[model samples]
Target: MKAFVVTLVALAVLGPQIARAEGGFKVEPSMLTDWKTVYGQVEAKDSIPARARLGGTLVELSVTEGDLVEAGQELGRVVDAKIAFQINAIDAQIAALESQMANAERELTRGEELKSRGVITTQQLDALRTQAEVVSQQLEAQRASRQVTEQQATEGAVLAPVAGRVLEVPVAKGAVVMAGESIATIAGGGFFLRLSVPERFAGTMKEGDAISIDTAAGEISGKLAKIYPLIEGGRVNADVEVADLNSEFVGARVLVKLPLAARDAILVPAEMVKTHSGLDFVIVATAQGPMERAVVPGPMTKVNGQPMMEILSGLTGGEEVLAHEH
Candidate 1:
């Protein structure tokens, strides 16, 4: 008992030197960001539907789901059999009008020759000119009508509105679709992360805030790009921009940690906390002696460029903790 008392006294005298040599940490409250863990979805910036311009049967489909396409690229062809028939009919009408126009021009030329020779009356020459003008106007009208029909035929080709991957192909080949009906849904304009957080955190969210994301490649940083004003279903929507984000799988959910607010927290040196039997412990020096107390440690952080561990419980401010040997 006497030797034990002497050993304790010696430790008390050398405690300061031991702490300085091993690197001691003071327990104090520091401000830390209060993070809220949530799931976010990888989404395309633009989700547009490729629609059919002309009502007809989809005769050819060049793309299906997960196919990449470019803007204005033909994805399918909508063939309206009636449109072809109409075009053929217009061609026939145009041919007939061209023949009539030729005949009218010949008669007008003959009339002019006769008038120059004083063989035809002025009234008769005027009649021939009038007939030729009527034929020319009719031909012009038929040509315009044919052009309109040809334009309708051109509309049968369904073109992609944007360059992106085809997400959904609603109509298959040989399926009849109406004008303005969606043929496939395309995702374009690059990729971003979409988040739906609780409305309670709306006021805390701000644009341009740094966000942490947990991805398959590991944790990555992102920025809070947008926050919507309208709230729905008690959730507030937001968009996060991440560089080099994996866009291979759109709509993939990823774990996210958002800094909602900041609060005071007690932190200690990470080396000071030791884990054993699935429970963490720290050494606290008191007048009696050094006592090993059970503690609940939170995530590791850094302070003043030094690694520190958050003490969730079993320690408080002004408590002297002994640093473990490295």
Candidate 2:
């Protein structure tokens, strides 16, 4: 414990020295491209909203934002109070009507027996028969109305129509919602990177053109999926589809490298490049000592299964660089 405490104190005292100690890098020339990098955003290919087919107050919301859902998944419950009450009322009316029909049938049987024994008149039997028929028809109508109400009640459960990640749930629990109102916004798993390119490069860009996406998971390749017909503010918008990525990039910003034309560049080992205040620099060896020179670094690439960066400007070929080891 004593040694540990001493180490902590030493680290606190040497914090500034440790931060300032950075290694230097060397530079070399290689064939590279002057590719133009345009900022792009990864978006869902088709973001569809899951809507409520029946109107009611939203209740028991189960799906949350960013939750993955499958087809036929229950997102929440909708309580249509009026429909429930109507069903109950219809049920009660059906019960009463059924009881009345039973009594009318018994009375019609008695009237038939009396008429056969000549104990009742034919007009009385005819009246009893008409009453029984009318009661049966009324019962059927009530049952049909009840079925409609029950169907409405069954539709109260909100269901997801597609398999995807839920992007947003706009309505809150206990909020009154109308039929066809969107309950959740879902991105249907298919993702694409959206690139806004300058209109000057429109003729150069074509469908299926290859591009690279710079992300936290390093760089990956994608292709142009579409080109829009309209150009806004001197920029043409297009979508690039990348495989093997989930919805993680669905609204994330990524650096997109579009091939412009090829040019000669100074290639250096990736580790040799140092950064300060977002600017890249390399060390050059002179008779006096090692000197730091600012250099604009381009896209990172592999020259022979080894990572390298292209230097866009700063040094011409064959400059002796100082490679400092940390």
Candidate 3:
């Protein structure tokens, strides 16, 4: 009975160990994505300029470089002395026309009375009415001219074309600018990473592939959003879309890893490969019992959410590696 009790205790302690050793991972070829490291720049989707609507002097500037602005927001004011002068001239003409119109109506009224009294002929009264109509038309024309001048004056204020940060301000207060001159350069439409990849990978690159970004904070994942058809200077342009992308600095360079192709390789748990005397080895279970076989280990990878290491050489399919000892 004592012997049987001791045997039961030993079995209880070694049962789990024996099971793990017998259930070693079987090596098989699996697909792995090959990545290509490249540099990419943080770029805004749109870089537009806030332009002046009319030629004038920049009277007031409300924003500077690196300031955030909104679409259609007023960034500066321009003043054209000529525009104000034209408005004043139009007003004067309108006033003169009004006085003339009043005089013509009075003359027409007097002519009507004179005709009723038979003091004036009907032809004379008709001529007076025609004169009054001409004065009225002149007044209408002058009023319309005044409105046009006012509208031109209102357009002297420069407005932003898009919502974003101000990148460049080419003009200062009191500086002269043309109607289409840029007041400020704005970067807008959100931000994305623009990549220049080697032309040889064009055939393998595709949209919607997962991409890895190395930022100052940590590694973040992104998606390959677009691939341009044109190849410039033997480089293909691509765009990466990432949520929570850092846009603190425009034109900032970032390290990126893109999946260019896929290939089949053998992988095993990282712990399965042990290093001894500057050499790596793996314990392979075989008909002759466990044997330590020298192997070459490649980069580390993940398999089914577990950390794995790729076997570059000295391993074959259908081979089983023993569980790494603690």
Candidate 4:
């Protein structure tokens, strides 16, 4: 009778534990939604070098590093004493040519009068007319030379080609510079986020596509400005011009999120999904027991601007999933 009672007690104790293990669900329901993919990098819209068109010693630098300058504003000047002196000399030559042309004109008039009265031969008149024409041509040539000299003098004054902050001033006052040498560097316009999309994703993106950039400062919206045709390192380069990044620093690192075609998906916290043996899965609580289901993950997305992962398959809405722990 005692043995029978012990047997009954063991059965009573084991049955509930087995039923609890099989029938009770341990996890809570996790809402699922679509997600987007993102990458991070430092980027800028454009960087242009300010070069000197004429070689000379830098005589004056009106702009300092980090100074904002407007397009066509003069930044500095090169020492152009030689060009000025040459211009002055050309003016003197032009004056001399003008005097010679006047004298030649007077001689031609005299010859014309003498020929009309038959005092001078037609040949002599013709020669005087030719001399006047030659002097006129010389004056024209001198004027042309003077114009060239003036243009060079103007070019000696360095000007900013675009409106932006000056990033660097490589040349200082009294520093000799050569033609085509960069005198300063400028970060034109405002900041932009540059992204390199994998070649596989190149066709999915286009100019004017909307993108979101997250920086240390804040999040900003931007549009794809350009997509390069050539592929390098299995990646395609693209530029994202930030329309609202007026206050952000140029070349600052930012996270860029790209949206794909819309589709229904189950969303979960990224950390909750784990990979094991090259397989991705999420632990879910079922009516029978805790279960690990295989899943395909899509790009991460934002929910109310919060980061979330898209579960492509395996889990359904209102299902309980264990929170992922580090």
Candidate 5:
């Protein structure tokens, strides 16, 4: 009878274990949620470097750094008074030549009339006509020189090429500048979020791709404007122009997030996945025992604001998994 009691106790203890193994394990279906890759940086859609076309000493600076300016607005002036003086001298020379040409024309007309009346020889008339022609040519040449000098004087006044706030003013009054050297920088019309993406993911990026920007102050929506053709330091640089950003976003640092298309897949908390060497896997409870399954993880998605990794392959729905160590 004692032996029979022992058998009964052993069966009772083993029955539940056998039942659990036969039924396997039950797990909740992985929830589907939106996912994105994020990056942070200060960005502007357009940056214009204002440079000088002619080298000269800066005589005046009208705008300071961060000042708002309009297209064609005079930003500063270079000391080109010498050019203006040269223009004035050329104008004076042109005026003198014009007077000389008028005198020669009058003399030529008189000489032609005298020749027609047989009062002067054809050679004298011809000489007077030739003189008038020479004077006309000289006048034209002087006018052209005056025009060139005037153009140089006009170019001395540096103007803003586009309407925007000046980001930097690198030169001060009395500073000597060279042609093509940047005097100031302006942030052009639109705002953009600058982000660097990993080269692997950057290959998927295209112009006009949608993105979201989150700043400490607020969130704004934007689209990818352009992807730089070359990669630097194993990363790709891209610009996302903000479509709905307000005035407050000026000069603010923002985080940009890019979302990819959705696919049918299982998602688990990143903490629930483990990595050994270069292999990625998860520990799932099975009917036999705890089994390690290899998994191909796609881009991570967010669930309840937590990172959830998508399982591209391996493992099925309703399987138990162990959380990764902290």
Candidate 6:
């Protein structure tokens, strides 16, 4: 009789545990999503080098590093004394040509009158006409040369090539700069995130894929801007253009989550799984009783914005796991 009572107490003790596993808790198959994570940072895709078109003294510099500017805005000016002198020389040449043309015109008229009176031959009249044409050609040439010089003078004023924040000002006001040298650098066309991925995903990743970037402010949505063809150091690089990132500065670091390819993964509610001794465990109801198995967790994701954990192994979508809070 004491043995029977002891057995009854043991059954009562096991009943609750079995009942909890069977009815008190729920079990369901895990869900799956196709996504991956990659690390990267914010970068500027279009950095323009604001350069000097003509060599001269840089004057009236108005932008510094980290200053915002717009397209065609004047960043600074250059003064070339030689350009002004060239213009002055062209004006003098034009003045001389005008005087010569006037003289030639008068001579042509005199020659024509003489020929009408038979005082000079037609050959002489033709020579005077030729001199007038030559003077006209010299005047036209001088005007063309002056136009070119004037264009060079106007180009002395450095203008912003695009609308963006200025990154650097390499030249100082009143400093001498050479032609085609960068006076300032501007980050244009907005900011983008540059990501590096393992070379294995280079073939699957493509432009226009969705990407998410995490900033201090919050998470931002973005898309793949470009995929580089060349692989470097066992990885491939890509550019990501995010929405509302125009305000973001260049070289700002951000955590990026990008999808490489579709994958069939099992995900469970984050609360349903528990970690013990460095391994994940989930309770499963078996014919004998409740059982626990080790699970491999891959990544944390969201289903309809609900938090979940991805299971890499130890459970497929076909198995039902008991939901319990540890």
Candidate whose TM-score is highest: 3
lDDT of 5: 0.70
How do the residues 55-109 of candidate 4 rate in per-residue lDDT, one tens digit apiece? 8999888987878888888888876668888988999999999999999999999
Q: What tens digits encode model 1's per-residue C-alpha lDDT throughout 224-320?
A: 9999999999999999999978887789999989889876677776777899899999877788977789999999865444567778999776677
Which segments of model 5 are wrong by more than 4 Å? Answer: 1-37, 203-210, 246-252, 260-326
The lDDT for every candidate, in the order shown, is 0.82, 0.76, 0.84, 0.70, 0.70, 0.76
Model 5 lDDT per residue over 141-209, tens place:
998888887777677778888888888898898999887778788776766667788888776677886
Q: Residue by residue across 1-326, what tens digits does model 6's lDDT show?
A: 00000000112112111112334233234323345677777677689999998899997799999998999999999888998889989999999999999999999999999999999999999999999999999899999999999999999989999998899997788899999999899988867778888988788777887777777778888888899888899999899887777454677666787665554556665776898799889876678866888999877865446566767888765455666643
Q: For every model shown, what is its TM-score relative to the native structure?
A: 0.83, 0.66, 0.89, 0.65, 0.65, 0.76
| Sequence-dependent TM-score of model 4 | 0.65
Q: Which residue pairs overlap in candidate 3's backbone?
A: none
Better of 4 and 5 by TM-score: 4
Determine which window of 10 residues in candidate 1 has minimal summed lDDT.
1-10
Whichever of 3 and 6 has more lDDT, that candidate is 3
Stretches of candidate 2 exceeding 4 Å from the true structure: 1-34, 107-131, 261-326
Could you tally the backbone clashes for each prediction? Answer: 0, 0, 0, 7, 0, 0
Greater-lDDT candidate between 3 and 4: 3
Report the Cα RMSD per candidate.
7.9, 12.5, 8.0, 13.0, 13.0, 9.8
* Model 2 lDDT per residue over 2-25, tens place: 000000011211111111113333
lDDT of 6 at 89: 91
Could you tell me the TM-score of candidate 3?
Answer: 0.89
Q: What lDDT would candidate 3 get against the real structure? A: 0.84
Q: Give the TM-score of candidate 5.
A: 0.65
